[model samples]
Target: MSAEIAPQPLLQVNNIEVVYDHVILVLKGVSLQVNHGSIVALLGANGAGKSTTLKAISNLLRAERGDVTKGSITFEGRQIGKSDAPQLVRRGIIQVMEGRRCFEHLSVEEDLMTGAYTRRDGRAAIKQDLEMVFNYFPRLTTRKSTKTGYISGGEQQMVAIGRALMARPKLMLLDEPSMGLAPQLVEEIFQIIVRLNREENVSILLAEQNVNRALKVADFAYILENGRVVLDGDAETIRKNEDVREFYLGLTEIGKKSYRDVKHYRRRKRWLA
Candidate 1:
């Protein structure tokens, strides 16, 4: 019988440490991997280094005066230490940032077109992808001519994701796609994200604080605390973990407990132990 080759991870972050402005040590030996055609969620609290991890992967740290002080980041087996954001984008890794950033003055369609700026594949191809984006986010079709800033928050979020879709990314770094939106809108955005993953075959590295919500859509998950990955497993296993239930998901053995009831309960630091 012939031997089968193992597939390399689509993205790899190996024991990386991040420092901001040469002083603030943020990510301490943090490491993760996103396999081909899988949705991997990076779960944590606000300061747990989720966004920093995304920025690290996308090479956006330099603009913020941050640096990867240790370890390595590789995309498809090539070390990306010196690769810039534009280069990464050209290579099909796109980051939809946390704040749903878009050009306020640009119409929704115009904002989306910018995502295709790096492509040399010609206008006809770009327009085809734009239509693909609209198909996934049908709400965008109705607001395509409106200035992005004038749209509802949910629509603006749709615009942000739609713009990233226009890039035709192979891997998407989604930072908190559910932030600052209604419950319904959050669900809607996540549904579109899953659709993108399944239909487009785009691998995703999702950074989110919404443990319950992120786990629902994630195929695999890593939980971070104070800049290190504390626990990791398939999404379903992580969901049923007792410590994760009590700490992150706000559930306990009996039932849901108020912060007042569980305030004094010591959260076990499995990483430290």
Candidate 2:
């Protein structure tokens, strides 16, 4: 029998550095990969360059006067360092940005239709995909005609995800899908994220802070501090790591710390050494 060849990852971000203007370094030597049919989580604090990394991949950094100063990002076999955002979107990479940025004036269905704007596929295919989104987010079915701003926060988050689904993405960059929602809604969103990966075969690169929730859905995880990847491993292993359990998960040998204490406690990360 012949030796089988291992396949390359669906997306690869290699030792990338990002900067705003000609100064202000953001990401430094940060590299990670998302394999086909897998979810990879980028776990970090607020200023840890998580969003900057996603914006770099989606080529959205330029809008904010940011640029990838070093290294490269590739999707499949293509080097996409200079590719425009629309080009990436057409190439089947979609980014659902944080804060549920829906078209508030537009109806829920209309907001979703915008995702297919780059598609050359016929209207029939588009309509079918719209229904597919609806199937995945049944809550949006009744709210289809409602303006996005009029819906509840949870419903708007659903619209944001549904809109991305309409793009028929090969890979989805989800930035904090659980941000600012109630605990119950956060659980629901992550459940749908898993279904999208397993059932629809969409690979995910998620930038998140909710380590506990993110670990439940991620296959692999990379922890970021400042502008660098400090540690990475399989999600199960990360969940049990003593450092992770203490700093991010609020678990200590003493006991679980309250959110107030955990947030205030200075993070003495050994990973930085």
Candidate 3:
């Protein structure tokens, strides 16, 4: 019998470096992979270059005067280095950026419709997808006709995710989906994300600060510090790691200590050494 060949990655980022305004380097030789139909979490603190990495993949860095000056990013065997944001969207790659940016003036439904602007598939399919989004996010159904600005922060986040779903993405680069929301709302949103990955087969590259929650949902995880991937492994392994438990998950043999305190208390982590 022939050996079964493993499937190629849905998205591959190889040794990429990002710089802002051609001067300030943000990501230093960062690299990772997202296999087809898998959820990969990128966990890190604020300003750890997680968002920058996502922007590079979705080709949205240009708007912020940032550029991928080294290495490459490819989606399904095609290089996307020079692709524009809209062009990437048309190719089934969409990014739900940090801050849950919404068309504040538009109704919830209208905000979602904007996500399908790249599609030429006509209104029937679009309408069907919109209903599917509502199914995943029942709360969105209640606020469909309400202006997005009028909704709560959690609802706006749902609108953002629903809008991305309307794009029917093959790969979704989600940056900080749990930011500034109540714990219950965060859990609700992540449940939907898991459903999207398992049932819809949409591959996800999630950048998150909530380590405990991210690991619970992710198949694989990468930990970043100061723009570099410090450690990476399967979710189970990462969850059990001492450094991860102490630094990210707020667990310690002695007692719970802040990450800043831990950083200064120890000489340096083995990964950094």
Candidate 4:
């Protein structure tokens, strides 16, 4: 008889619930998993418990008067809810939060170095890692000495991502990396994430409101509505689904056209008049 093999999950959240001040319940029973070297997208509307899930995993839910009332979050086959943020970082699970919360007063290089605080490795190794981060984000290297507050929003976002990379994470929890950025910048950031997953083999658990673009890049996807996973499947399948198209992606049968078409139509109407 062949030995039965157990499927290994890099991170797992089974029936987790979080509440704020014992009054407002945020996450009802959210659950998902990320395997090795795969991108999983958690898609939903605003306040749909996407960020809440990331916070729950990182033990940062406390700041918002929140606590996980039920269930467990395991990372690398070990339960981690009791571990502090620094401990979690040491375990190689890092989160680039919703806001690109770099220290405004600090230089860009200094902000990235903060992620390496948990490391006790030799200075040469640290320097090498720093160089690697810069290689991935050369724009940051050019402005390494500048205060983070003065950089563009997109650059600050890069600093946030680079800082997380400095931790040498086995898994990355990214919350809304494309938010509030221009269309060009959003594309740039998504490309960087795709490269990170493909080139570096970094397992990513991405919680994003930009459903269309996320589904395009993710290997697998989970749709969270009202704190429950209403849909789960391969990314391409979900992208083609009618329900997903209407609710999340907002893609209509007419198809998406560039903004230039609308302007051209307006000009034609004025000329006809």
Candidate 5:
């Protein structure tokens, strides 16, 4: 009998360090991988270098005066050294930023159309993609004519994701898609994300603060603290970890505690030793 071959990663970040404005060192020896057709979560508190990691992969750090000072990043078997962000997008890697950025003045449909800028496909294909985005986010169809700024926060978030979808990405770098939305909306978005992963076969690298939700949807996960990867494992293993349960999930044998208190308690975890 023949042995099974392990598949290569769709994206790889190896021991990368990021620095800002030539002085502020941010990411410290961060490394992770996203395999084809899988959802990998990057979990951390605010300022934990989650977003910076995504930027490093997409090569967006240059615009922010940040540079990868060490290590390497590879995508689809090619090294991405000093690659341009737009070129990355053209290569089917797209990033949906943290804030759900939208063109306030542009109509909802127009905002989505911007995602297709890199494509050389015809108008018919673009129209088909627009309908596909609307199918995933039915609310966007209803607000197609509205100015993006006039829509609800949840709707704005949908627009952001829909816009990224318009790019026809093979790999999506999603940063904090759950932030600032209602619990229901967050769940809704994550369901759609899972559908996109399973149904559309798109690979995902997600940076998220909502540990519980992210773990539920992700295949593999990495936990970051103070700009470094402190722990990582398969989702089930991570969820069962005592420290993760206490610090991130806000769950303990006793009850849920404030995250502020949890942050202080994390210093004593064996993983940090």
Candidate 6:
């Protein structure tokens, strides 16, 4: 007998409209899909409903104040829009929310254990998973017993991502993972995400403002503007699109070529000098 093939499309978000108080519409009609073992990016500026879309998928929408008014979110071929956040975790869909929401009072290791609250695995397996996280983020292991509030921001971000991993998710919703990090640290975090996608085969739906970096890593990308998906295509195609460059990239027709030529000129000037 042959080994069974894993199912495709770990998560799918189709035409989701999120509204606040039945008056304000944040996401007009956002549709996105993430295949198994691929990295996808949702690129948009602030207030573009990127985070709201993530909340809708994770079923963390504030029901009394905000909610998904229409459309469906499916995880592993099952509808999950109405499911609660904890139920989503049990379904192997987890979100590493924006702002690196860590338990400041809890120790690093303790915080990670919170993710395993729904796990039915044995304690020994949980322990081994903890060690695996330690290997991926060595700093977390060094500060395992330290309170999360005392750790550096980069370390805290690692703790947040590690905590999500502890749940053994098939798909991760990463909201602004590069937010508030130093330039070097942002690069470091992106590399780690790439590694996670490749090594663990974990699908990722990344909401990011750092287009230059996010497009480099994502296989597919969607560009949202004012609550609508204005552009959707393969990463490389979007990267090279003239319209995307002019509008979203903040570079005009001639401006795009000027950037390239300027770099060439600087390199030549250095060689001559």
RMSD of each: 3.0, 3.4, 2.9, 8.6, 3.0, 8.1
| Separate clash counts for every candidate | 0, 0, 0, 0, 0, 0
| Residue lDDT tens for model 5, 1-273 | 001233678888999999999999999899998888889999999999999999999889998999999999988889986789999999889999999999999999999999999999899999999999999998888899999999999999999998999999999999999999999999999999999998888899999999999999998999999888989988889999988887788678867777677757776553563
Off by over 4 Å in 1: 1-6, 254-273
TM-score of 5: 0.93
Candidate 6 global CA lDDT score: 0.86
Residue 17: error of model 2 in Å? 0.4
lDDT (tens digit, per residue) of candidate 2 on 132-194: 999998888999899999999899889999898888999999999999999999999999999
Off by over 4 Å in 6: 1-8, 256-273
lDDT of 4 by residue, 1-273 (tens): 001232777899988999989888888888888888788999988887899999999887878889999999999899998988889989989999998998999999999999888988878888899998898888888899999999999999999999998888889999999988888998999999989988887889899998988987898889887776778887888899876775566565867756587558535633542
Worst 10 residues of 3 by lDDT: 1-10
Output the better candidate (1/3) by lDDT.
Answer: 3
Q: For model 6, how does the per-residue alpha-carbon lDDT over 70-146 read when each residue is reduced to its tens digit?
A: 89988888888778989889988899999999999999999999988899998998899899889889867789899
TM-score list, all predictions: 0.94, 0.93, 0.94, 0.89, 0.93, 0.88
For all candidates in order, the CA lDDT equals: 0.89, 0.90, 0.90, 0.86, 0.90, 0.86
User: lDDT for model 2, on a 0 to 1 scale?
Assistant: 0.90
User: What is the C-alpha lDDT profile of model 3 across 1-273, one tens digit per residue?
Assistant: 001233678889999999999999999999998888888999988898899999999988999999999999888989989889999999999999999999999999999999999999989999999999889988888888999999999999999998998999999999999999999999999999999998998999999999999999998999988888888998889999998888788787878777677867544663453
Clashing pairs in 4: none
For candidate 2, the 10 contiguous residues with the lowest summed lDDT are 1-10
